[model samples]
Target chain A: MTHPFGPATRLALVVLAAASLAACASTKPAGPVAPRGPAEPEAPYRPPSQPGPVTQEQAPGVTPGSVQDFVINAGELVYFDLDSYTLRADAKPVLDAQANWLRRWSAVRVRIEGNCDERGTREYNFALGARRSNAVKEYLVSRGIPASRIDTISYGKERPLDPGSNEEAWARNRNARTAITEGAR
Target chain B: MFRTKNLFSVLLAALATLLAAAPIAARADIVVNVDQGVTQPLPIAIPAFGGSSVGGQVSQVVTADLQRSGLFRPLDPNTFVQKRIDVNLQPQFDQWKQISAQALVTGQVTNDGDGRLRVDFRLWDVYAGEQLLGLQFTTTPENWRRLAHKIADAVYEKLTGEKGYFDTRVVFVAESGTKAKRIRRLAIMDQDGANPSYLTDGSYMVFTPRFSSNSQEITFMALRPTGASIYLLNIETGRQEALGHYPGMVFAPRFSPDGRKVAFSVEKAGNSDIYVMDLGSHATSRVTTDPAIDTSPSFSPDGSQMVFNSDRSGSPQIYVMNADGSGAHRISGGGGRYTAPVWSPDGKLIAFTKQEGGQFHIGVMNADGSGERILTSSYLDEGPTWAPNSRVIMFFRDSAGGGPRLWTVDVTGRVTAQAPYPLSASDPAWSPLLN
Candidate 1:
């Protein structure tokens, strides 16, 4: 937004006659397209102002089927093997149930949070977490759910379900979880 | 939230120790050996300065700086044969030699007529009884630490023939709170774990902060509930700008060698790809097109090629490609998962994080993916960032009982030291040597 109009376009003028200065010829040139920043989104750079620790317990506050109920009945959590974003066959039934539940509460929007174990690098885990969340969201969308209804966020290894460092804990941590962020239908 | 200004302030106390070192120089004419295996830290003595009380504190800073480099062992002050050696005194070679001190560093700090701190230091070879290096600096009292760092650099260079990294800064993420409610803020500190100050408030989760080659600007990933965005923060001005707004999650952001472009990863439709964006035009071009995850991009020193981590090989491994996304080839072989490949400053080697067994390691390999050597292994030792000299790497190590803390490792794997910080820290990005 700080860039001004007519920026990036430099025009040169040549006066061949004494009176030519009074009669100016102008031309509009093709200019590069400028990408609009998120200034319209009210402080786009800052996250939501609620600064605190993040955890799964934050999911129980939603209306229709308590967020915890959605986790229990619809199987809102999906687990992935090490270094693999591909869901196992066991994850399909959970996605099917999640899709059915989301269809019933069409007015409620959900967010899929992906996570990783603390094994790999943080940034790489971030991308892996992103892939995992989108994998879950893609499954939901493929099952007749609207893509717009599901938002995906990846916490990498920042938020772990269990504090243990063993295999059981890592397996449980490398998961994708779904929560209802918007009000329920 | 973990925003307590002193949520961990055990750091400043650690700075009280002197970090001086033994010289690599074996003889009067011998410079510090260039070989990593030839490390014989020179024994040096630095008595309290004669002039001001601050001079004594400054001597501690210099000693701490040198000792932290792992190249020198500062002798105990009680071991000084001479009780009070004056900076202006003639050569006390016999007194320093009596304590087996190979080098004697003496300095004096005086308040000039205008109140400036006029600091002078002399590095002497005890055996040769000749002054090895002598320098004086005049600065305001506020810059006393900088004066110490300058003296350390001079001593280190005189002995090792390599410029020291003490005069540099490290930008990292300082973490607080429990695992479920973690607060991560961008923090910067001296390379010797001094002068740590948070750059950003822990309002949002900040990740993957990397210094630009210019060292003035830092690009990192910030996550909010709405979405994740890549942002550029000016270190001096504290001005921040959204580098890019992608349709999906963008992470693992890095600046090009020239600071003119950035390479980052964006995940869309279950696929993650690396994209390079020119800073001037804000135009981005995708570097990887496969369905597999392709992220953690690092450009070669010459900027003609880029080495990045991709899962195109079934497991995440290192890959190399041209700057324009052509001729992509896999460079990593063997077992385990290889990710987080960072090209060295000299353009000849790449330092990376490898997870083969249950353990994670920091390793280095040639640009062609050959001569791979594992430097350090631990429960989790990832994110390898090379020093400007390519001789050292700083990474975060996390174990069962301990949280992640910054640590440095020599490429030879012989010298390992913790970048001591009182609080939990991670994702250390070393800046280019400052002016």
Candidate 2:
């Protein structure tokens, strides 16, 4: 069969496509620019030597035994399957790292925050989230962290990490996060 | 339910005498049988009241109230052959019969010249040509809407042999913002979605606000990043107090039928169970000891039995047990996940949210789990609350990628409509009819 469109319509389509391409091209930055320092420094700045790989304790800006350090060196979140409190296989490593971090910072008191996706009802999800946070707390306690140093709260589906209504967002939302509620530097 | 039925029969017997003079063949009374699976709406005509602007507005409100019930079809004024009506005088039955109106409502509003408005209305059975009800209400001029609702209630009760849900209020959680950071506040409004006011300032998230039997108090759960708390709030006085501290998260609070106690769920160390607390004594009792999730406890109208949600059978399902937590047995059967089971005020049916086939549904079933009926199905429809009359159920429906809005469905599933509120809302709790 012949082309479905006449010459004028085909010409208009080509023009529209070209206009969309121009719009897309405009979104990209033209080039990279050098960073600018502050106009004035409180004290004369000294250029330090290029630093080698440093431990989290010696890292710049991140204080040792702090909330930021725990978040950076050890993952704070572990995800669960939908409508489940069973920790995923991949989540085991994260919780293991968290357990080790908590053991090192023995004085840090943490709260395990449990959450769920939007698929469940409000009251039921609250119970489900409690189960999830408890799952994390139990795992940590099993790995040598004292139970007394930890607290748990279930946000249910009230607090969501991802707002999208798709499976990926729901996966991210069903999680338990270890929050440093006290004893952080 | 038995008390209301007795009252209805008594009213019917009294009205029978008024029809005694008519021929026996024409003595059939007008009644709407609401128990059937399908019902044809009774056609009624409500003309503008005779006196002032408030008169017309009152008539409009009364008309709207009856229309929204899905039990009455208010005829258009253009179809009214009788142009004028007087509250004290009889209507022309021939004109009403010609337009197929089974019931006629006539009323007049008078300003007493002392800042009070006097309104009187009469409900007539057009077929029998007899007055079924005549009542007058006197109130401040600004309270015309409530007066109109009272009149609507009178008409509904006279025709259907059941109490009316008009003149009541609904307490719900008004939600705004994105799902990730939603702001939910306790909100209340007239049953028709008028005179809405926020009871809480949307600072922390609130959920599942349930009205007490008296309609003056509500118990709701407020969730914060730190923890969760259940609060009992007196709506009339704006006085609120936390339901005391528990060892764990406390949520899903609901008042007993008599409004003397509150039942809620407390979660500790990943396990959740139901508990009840007496408001007067402040004594708390554990209702369920199941290791699995046991939440959302709703009491039967007589306060003898409790229906709640549980997952002990490996999936979320509804269960019924004694008020003291004995003889708990699963009441929900089938393949769906049933949650949020609320016992109807009439104590005949249980409403719930069922999730099956990747779709959520609002449904009701007999208290024994027999005669299951799904009223609505959508991407998400949850948290079903029964109207005071138990004929209608209000719930929230959340669209994919959108916020939730309140919706109502009658028991027969024959009529469904979105609530008039224009914001994201959920967890609707309908109050009992105002005294």
Estimate every model's Cα lDDT from 0 to 1: 0.80, 0.86
Number of the top candidate by lDDT?
2
The local lDDT score (0 to 100) that residue B130 gets in candidate 2 is 80
TM-score to native of every candidate shown: 0.83, 0.85
List residue ranges in candidate 1 displaced over 4 A. Answer: A1-69, B1-28
TM-score of predicted structure 1, chain A = 0.64
Candidate 2, residues B379-399: lDDT per residue as tens digits?
A: 999999999999999999998
lDDT of 1 at B135: 70
Angstrom error at residue A164, model 1: 1.4
Give the per-residue lDDT of model 1 (tens digit) for B1-435: 112222122111112223233223344553666456347877888887668878888889889988877778789999776655677665668888888888778988888898777777778888887777767776677667777887888888888887777767888999988776679999988787777888888989999899998777899999987789999987766778998787678888899999999999998876889898899999998888998888889999899999988888677899999988899999887788898999988888999999987889999889998889898989999887887877779999999756888999877787888886767999899988766
Q: Which residue pairs show backbone clashes in model 2?
A: none
